[model samples]
Target: MQLTHFNASAKAGVSRASSRRTTVRVQAAAARPSWFPGNKLPEHLDGTLVGDFGFDPLGLGVDKDKLRWYQQAELVHARFAMLGAAGILVPDLFHQIGAGGPAAQIPWYDHAKFEYYAPINALFGVQVLLFAWAELRRLQDIRNPGSVNQDPIFSQYRCVCACV
Candidate 1:
């Protein structure tokens, strides 16, 4: 008896290797920062993205260029960590999706748990974005299925990716 896995490059059903490494390579190539994980979107609902916003946090309405390093680093660091966290959770998350439950079933919003859903949704949305992207790519792996696709808000990461 044999268990075979496909080489990521060419086709799904291909050759067999004793120990093939796919996830690590993808993760390494992604090179996501420990501080900011790729899965979490750095942007907020206000459309203000990570680090320094183009506008002002002080209500001075200044540009990101005007901000200091520590301030910017703080946000940068948080965003990076969330992004990485999302990616790390991908494997098992997808497995659960495939089994029988969809993402919506998860405790995304425990109405009983929160007096408000806005901020919670926002933070969770970032996490969801990461899960969403993974489930989209690996629907088969998801324990329960959810219609996975790009969350337009989180797509801002595309720009961040280019800048980095």
Candidate 2:
């Protein structure tokens, strides 16, 4: 299912439990399941509904215990990468291109223009995804011995570099 859909469902679930809160411990039992407390974030937060607080994958407002150390680090990396990529592209490329001013005069296939920028952005996005997947593989390895394998993305990178 789509991440957004999952998030919505999780949010609905949370709201439903929250709305049933009374002066009883039923709310606690309804909100958090037995297995919900100890499993890794991906096990629980994979379908978590987040709010407007910057891509809340786990719906965790400020509770840092929801995610493990590597997951947290990866989230931080992703946030910074997104900000940096947007910071450069929005102002330097998108804004200029959208404005249709002197920047538009530059050829699309120029050395430092859209040609290189597009490919670099594509590569960066793929690399980021690969890195995140590698982290997931690490988690899997921890769960089951010898579960992780060599990263295919890195192998592809090597092959492409060799060809070039």
Top of the candidates by TM-score: 2
- Model 1 TM-score? 0.20
**Candidate 1: misplaced stretches above 4 Å?**
1-67, 99-164
Predicted structure 2: lDDT = 0.51
TM-scores of the candidates are: 0.20, 0.22
- Candidate 1 backbone overlaps, count: 25
**Candidate 1 residue lDDT tens string, 56-163:** 334433334433334544665788799777744663476466642343333433434635546776878899998767545443323233322333468543322221
> For candidate 1, what's the RMSD?
25.7
lDDT: worst 10-residue window of model 2: 1-10
In candidate 1, position 85 carries an lDDT of 74
- Candidate 2, pairs of clashing residues: none
Indicate the residue-level lDDT of 32 in model 2: 34
Q: Write the per-residue lDDT of candidate 2 for residues 107-143, one digit (tens) a residue.
A: 4445265444357878889999988886786566656
